[model samples]
Target chain A: MTHELLPSGIDLLDSALNGGFTKPSNFLLIGTPLSAKKEVGLILLNGGLERDEAAIYISTSNTAEEARSHWEDYGFKEQWEEEGRVKFVDCYSKMLSATVSDTPSIRRVPSILDYTKLSVAVNDWCTSYYLQNTPVRLMLDSLSAFLIYSSLQTVMRFLHIFLGQLRKQNALGFFLLEEGAHEIVTFNQLKTFSNGAIRVNEESNMMQLEGYRHGMNIPLPSAVVPKATAEASQVSCTPTK
Target chain B: MFKSNGQTTKVPTGISIVDTLLDGGMPNGDSFLIRAHPLADPLSMVIEFLHNQLKNGGVGVFLVNNKSPASVLEESAILKMGLRDFKRNGQLFFIDAYSALFGLRSNEAYFVEDPNNPVSVSKVVAQALSECSKKGKVFFVYDSLNTSIDEFGNAILAEANTWKRIAIAFNAILCFIYTEWNYPKDISEAVANLFSSIVDLITLERIVATQVVTVSKNEGTPVSKRMVPIKNAVTGGIKGYVPKILVTGPFHAGKTTLVHTLSTRAVSVQRMGTTVALDFGHVNHRGFTLDLFGTVGQPRFDPILERLGGEALGAILVVDSTKPEEFPRAKEMMHKAGVHGLPYVLAANKQDLPDALSVEEVKKKMNISDEVAIVGTVGTDKVSVVKVLDLLLDKILST
Candidate 1:
């Protein structure tokens, strides 16, 4: 079936997937240690930036500042980030006990082990971006860190709720996974939840997308959580323009 | 209004809702921990707290641990907190627990040679606090409890208790910037019990992550535990808090766009970009933080309108400028939402479309009262949408 997809900016992969990824979609990029999964993830991330889409990077392996600079090195626009269009949820910095002060462009996540906080961080970013009526693209640098820190069941539970929220919000999400990082059960379990996965070959750097246009459709876990706040000194009346 | 720890006057953080929530601001010599999620800005809160303290002729003592004092001062400059000025004027003092140990230096008067030395760090912090409080009302903040813990294990919590006592002794309010780093549960609970009030920076998933602040442990008066939406630091602080304001209209009337355009951060409980559930957003505008709730326009969703408009301070009724026929439907939805008596503004949206009508024309079609301001708006234009909110807020504030 044809779909209006956001191109991954990789011509070969774009053609293989019939243009690119569908909106309201979540796709996993699986590749071995030396494969191009990270490269592919960054390209899509950068592509989203070029298209003026709000992009969020959940970096478990690197500090938000590091992820940002690395993305910048790949020619991502600085203005988008400066303007709040690009945000990073760092599960890396504070994990290393590096005390970077709070700022808008980046947020600190306490630990990789705390998947709940990590999910909430992304949820916050996606919501913040959704205010403007633009598509949001979320890229997790690699899922290996999460798998390493947490059980597959926990990571799967996180992804199910996380990706389901993205789909509901019509966001396009790409989660990178290092092949062989976990048991085959990890990959098999993820496939059941994801719409499909794009796998890059170990030696050839070639790619092929697996089918599951509509994932297993497991019902997303439901939990009701409530609302937000902004700064407040005084509310002296200002006449309207 | 509520006194604890024998503090003098209540010191305002300048954020209106918080002051009200804290019952006219945190009292001097009172201690509270702002336990924030990594995404929340405790620094901005600290800056605003210190700024108000300085402005009111009180003194501020900053015990730096997370970052160097120089870096703290340098970074806070973005908010124009005037730390340097306050320091020069003798109203602000910095105890360098981070800089001297790292071989860097700020022009701070007090410095600890070894930050890891609990007694030495305690001595320097206490000395800075004692010196600053002697001047008058004092606001002391431990830049971070999380980093202090990393630098000196679970002992930081013990140290925090000591500082709290010292601040209380001097009648100076103490604040600690603590971030949750998956510390031990018992220690986390212990840290919570150490403070009189806790301002938690929590993220709630209303389909999207929305940063919220809740106040608890406030003794003497009832703390509603009001969950307020927060924005990225605005120069002076959070301007004001309007808990709820409704954005109602017919489906496809640009209600979502209007909400999006006006909010600093927003999320719609939607499917495929259509607000099937509801839209929520926060905007710090014209010296107020307005929480906008955009309702699902379909009649099937009308049942939820009453809840959506439950406590809304005011409302914005969005309508398609070109389609006068749907005007009644928009009003009907608001009526069903039980917001008839509320002061609201009419947003004549889609004004950018070729067939759209003018603001006056939209007003005429809806037969809306003259008291309700009518604004012509293109949802894509932030200016026009803000104007709509501004008019509604003006009416809301007046009432």
Candidate 2:
């Protein structure tokens, strides 16, 4: 059976995966402390944004303002935000008791502990963008924050539903997790639901690619994080027979 | 029959601009709403009003909702007005409502058992007025209607209505301070309509939080509607002040564009498509006169930057978003302008470009601390330009 491939915005990784990860796939990014995990997520979103594809960043760790500042740092423009091609589901500010005013591109949830509210906000964003008939990039900054706040069983349940929705909408999903933060059994359980996974070692500054049910498990070359290229970040998914 | 004096029987609010706006002073036996933002404190205005009333030989009654009577007294003493002396003379009194919120009984001259109970609060105010009114025209100050609304819910409207009736019946000047931008639109509108006159204490951002007083509405008088900048007087009350802002950045970072965008009248000394010397613009925002000076971006124009940087209350450092390499130059320009340790905002320009870096990237490359505000801007985008200015002003005021 043939599967569509979506570029991960990293040249070596894209070439190693025989073009990219299969479309409609959920990819988990496991990184050690102070690794380039966030950079990878940004590259992926910028990849979609460069192609003018709609993208949504569900931020649990940073306020929407902080996220926007990061996006602009990587050479991304605000035109995409103004045009409604980019959106942020902010679940961080209210934790600090700061009021999050509603805007077109941002939906501020009352708290990160409110899994139901976060899911609703993400679902609403997906529903609207799904109608656009273009591929979408959905990034959850880090799952560890969620795990810290919620029970393992509860977070697993939420991700099961969330990943299922991403697959249904043909959206590319990136879920970030901290290495060694959870047990091996927890990793195995999450791995079962994800189609592919990449682990980043801050000490070695290298990323290892692994497949769950597919081939292309070869370790790629040293990942040279691209230095702020506008076009290099614009990788897209193309269907193949 | 009410004796008609040559001038209206009015109580000066202590804010000279506010008094001038109200056609000399707030008319006696009338209620006025002082709308302000929650972060913007109007307590100084209230305290000044009370001091003015005391000076005029009129008794003052302050219904405290958000602050403790002790805090009020401390703040009043800062103005050199001894609240204890006024209380001893039966010229000043406080009805503490904040203590009830904390489930504590206050030892103030008067206390409300239930701040949410409008009838009980009204009864206390009525009894106090009976005792105080004999002295002269009483000044009734409800420190804030918004705080009361928060505690008592919609009952505050009815409570205000009762206070209005009492003000009329007792021939006292009633002032209701409502924090602006904190209530629901419909509720704020409904409350605003209840007042015969509205004194809007608008907080404008510069290097520091400056205020302006405007009489938006006055039933019996011709309101000036003039924006008058207000400053805290050394002794007491608030006076008038102006703010000057400096706009400086690296070459081709859009400093000229920003100055042009914010300035009502902008003059630029440009030769060969670049600012050769400097750019000057003037903006009169909400009664505050802002003199905006735009420094030339070229490194060769360091002398001009230094000259414009002096006496600037605040500064804005504009940098090109797509050019991270230029951020160092931007920082250098800021230091050369003598804006070190001074309040300033970073304007990340060219954000409309596809190659533009995010504000975070610029901050990282420039080594800017998180505390310093960095706002995105696109040339010719009015909203983006205004947002940058507002952030710069907010940072200035906050510092």
Candidate 3:
């Protein structure tokens, strides 16, 4: 039996998913900087806002105000910010602030195990942000940052831990990462770990999105994850009169 | 009240709820930023203070000095403070200075956009505060200190000194200074500590409890200290403490059934019967709430479950006392939970089934060396279920 789906505020995207993202599932969105990956994440996230579900966006790049202003253009800025359903956790700051000053213990660091620990830390941080009986939709803007800081084996373990928490909470979440960072093996492993994933790309200097056989594969505008180009078929570029 | 007494005793009209938070009310002219965790009601507290002033029919005047554009400031104000009738009282005036932040136009006030030009920023703010303070009953808020920290850089000290000077001159100038946020715990703590020492009052809103507002931190040596728990008034909605516990065991060890048996409300979102994803439920016993999360016995899924259920204080590692051969995985799960210093219990489930490993045999394989308790249980029976919970609670209470 299907339950109520939260709309991402982008009409085409909401309708594309037959409403919105299914609750209690983990999905991935992959693209480069300015890929509109964050935009798509915000759409799903803002949908939760409409439902009065608390949504948290862990930004590895964008500022909270910048993210708010971008959504303001679509008339969701106030609802997302004021009513307090949406939040941003800047992981960039968290990681940057972590003191790597401890004397480096040179014991054999199990690449997979180390990554798992980092993942646990990330999950702990996310869990603490949750307040209210508000159903939550969590978005981690860039997993590549996690990967860059830790080993690839660790990244996989991290993903496993990260995805595991979301599933346990029955929350809808997305882990964003860059396309070229990992090899095919890691990609396949992540795809298997996730219930759904979408591949976003920039082609012919315009943005385009494709399905990864896990998440909604629809190419509709509202369902589109941002890519590098602003001229993606999904977004209207005409100046307002 | 505007006697020639050199003291500027202009107290902020803190709303009843918030005034109660500040121990009667904030002193007339102290400068402090509203410290907030990722999601604290800083704006609400400010508005409530305004509401209290209006409700009491006090003659207080507020001048909102915006360093950003007027449109941006107005839009944000509208979003935060809805245009309700209570907000329409005639004591508030808004000064649009957003243009000043971007090197734009200003009338009679020189804009301060350059960090190197602290002289200009300081001069402009000082002039505005001075003019506003002359109105007898006035409260000053800088909206945010984070922006000033950005524009002032290391010169934040100069900006702070400016506040110190303002407070000394007009003791009623309660300056709200906001610092830029990056969520670097150390940085935020350092800023909080620094501000706490200098400011007469410091209150921080840390979003720790789920959907509940409990005072997280207060450091200003108030006349009294009290923590207020704020909840949704209408729905009485709350995301109260739901401890996340993990249940694991060998294949078909009644792990799923155990969760269903013990849980008051439960659901499984696993793709495969072997729990490919995860399981969730809530356990209620005599007022304590335990949220149980379970995973299948497969090795590949074990780490994922362990990592997700990190730093748990309560874990129930289930073992099928009925299956002697599948005891190893149960022991392994117990060992993992122990590594994180989590207090756990052993549930020797399916005790009624024939050829069941006795509780002793199951505990031996698990090396019941420590004082951790073990209980023989039939996942379906309520009597057996309550016993298991009692054991878990005992472990929790003891710890």
Candidate 4:
């Protein structure tokens, strides 16, 4: 079966994936502490926004404003926000006992403990965008927050159901998981269901493609060099044959 | 003598809007169900009610379910009545249900050892009600019904019924707060039906936080569908109102000019004398803080306009009076902004110009309905801008 490919926004990464990620595929981003995993996720989302597509960022770690500030550092905030191509599902503020009134593109759920509410909120947003016939890019900031609040079994069930829903909607999904935060068995269980998996280690400033479910054998790069500046323009992933 | 006509005496609730809706206030021997979202704080309304009752020389019994008595007192410190003083004077009492939840013994005047035991809690509440009723009027407030349901399951229905019976027997006023979306549909409906009236405190998702109260069920008279805005307690203990208003029109229609003139602090993103993105302003008028969002008028900027239009409670459509040909574009901009059904006023800008048209002429040329208000004004005039805002606010609140 032929699969449509969407650009991952990072030119080198796109080249590495032959073209880009397959349409409607789930990618697991496993990052160590201080990794540039969030920046990678933002690049993927920026690809959709640049094409005038819709993107939803579900942040379990920070407020929507803070998440947007992080995206601003990547130079993708103003244009996407102005065009209304980006939406935020904030699950952090209420946990801190802050009341977040809903905005046009931001929905705040009361608590992350109520995964049911979060599920319903995400389902509603994806379904609405799907009905609009718009391609959707979804990013779940981190799974570590969910694991901390709920049991491993519950998180697994939620991700399973959520990924299924995204697949049915034909939307791309990026899920970030912190390394060392969970058991290897738990990480393996999540990675097994993903179409692609990448591990980011910030201490060495290196990224490796651990696996790809499609069996597309792309040559692995020996090392990834880090750029000196923090600007999005300065960062580039160089491939070493 | 307080008159009673087969019904309990009506007392004044601190909130004027609620008192008007309830004819005077909640009647004695009655219970009211306040349906609210869990995140939405209905506790403020209860605090105001209790404060009024206490001020009126009535005794109050606060049934603390989820929050501890200390927490409740801390929150009510805004009342400025000295909760400790009231408790010492035997005018205020607390039935602590939260202490047992934390496995700690409560040191309050009335403590329920086992909150999960509905029978014991109901008995304690009934005894408190009887004692408090010995005073002129007794006011009872159940901090939450959802917590009780969580603890005792279906037994909460029986407990609520017992509370109703006790309230009627002692001629007391009772208020029960329930969070929506927490329980099953049938259970919430069943609980709502058990009350004499239901006041739904709804939070409208506008740019500015807007809360309105509506009566879904009332046994006395027909309820009004018109929403009453809830006054937020501002600093210095004054009630203040804040609402969002969208400013939009055709290209070069003086929208940015009007926003700047009216707002004390206005920010506009303009490129070469034309607004490219948006203009935002904040204005304080007549106890209301209006957050105005002015959208780019060009059709190419419709996406931004739609984003800015979301959650606007009202709108101001600015049109240059001399440019009658742009009326179609003005109407299109309003449509793009998604402010069709919301309260809006048409501002005929450049009224000081020689070719400026009158409000009636602009209305006729723009094909505006009579229901919509129109005001003729120059963009730079403070008086004219205030007039336009006042008219729009009046129409918004009236609606």
Q: Which CAPRI quality tier does the interface of model 1 achieve?
A: incorrect
| CAPRI band for model 4 | incorrect
The better-scoring model by DockQ among 1 and 3 is 1
Poorest lDDT segment (10 consecutive residues) of candidate 1 chain A: A220-229
- TM-score order of candidates, top first: 4, 1, 2, 3
Worst 10 residues of 1 chain B by lDDT: B1-10
> Tens-digit lDDT track for model 3 on B107-206?
4222445433556656656765666566544555555454444334446555666665676687644545342233346546555554422221221222
Against the true two-chain complex, what DockQ does each candidate achieve? 0.07, 0.01, 0.03, 0.05
Q: Give the CA lDDT, 0 to 100, for residue B147 in model 2.
A: 56
lDDT of 3: 0.53
Angstrom error of the Cα, residue A210, model 4: value is 21
Could you say which candidate leads in lDDT?
4
Each prediction's TM-score against the native? 0.55, 0.42, 0.40, 0.59
lDDT of 3 by residue, A138-235 (tens): 77767776555444554554455456556555567878877877877767777676756755544433223333222333342433433422434545
| Model 2 C-alpha lDDT per residue in residues A1-241, reported as the tens digit of each score | 2367877676756766767767788888888766777777777787777777888888888998898897776656889889898899988765544333558899876555445346556766776777676678888888888777455665675676667657766788988998888999888888888887877655544566667423333222222344323333453322222
- Give RMSD (Å) of candidate 2 vs. truth: 19.9
Give stretches of model 3 more than 4 Å off: A1-199, A204-241, B1-12, B51-120, B150-154, B175-186, B193-225, B231-399
Q: On residues B9-119, what C-alpha lDDT tens digit does candidate 2 reach at each position? A: 666665556766776678778888878743345666777778877887888888876556665666567666656578778788888866775577877778989776777
Interface quality of candidate 4 as DockQ? 0.05
Residue B217's lDDT in candidate 2: 82
TM-score between model 2 and native: 0.42
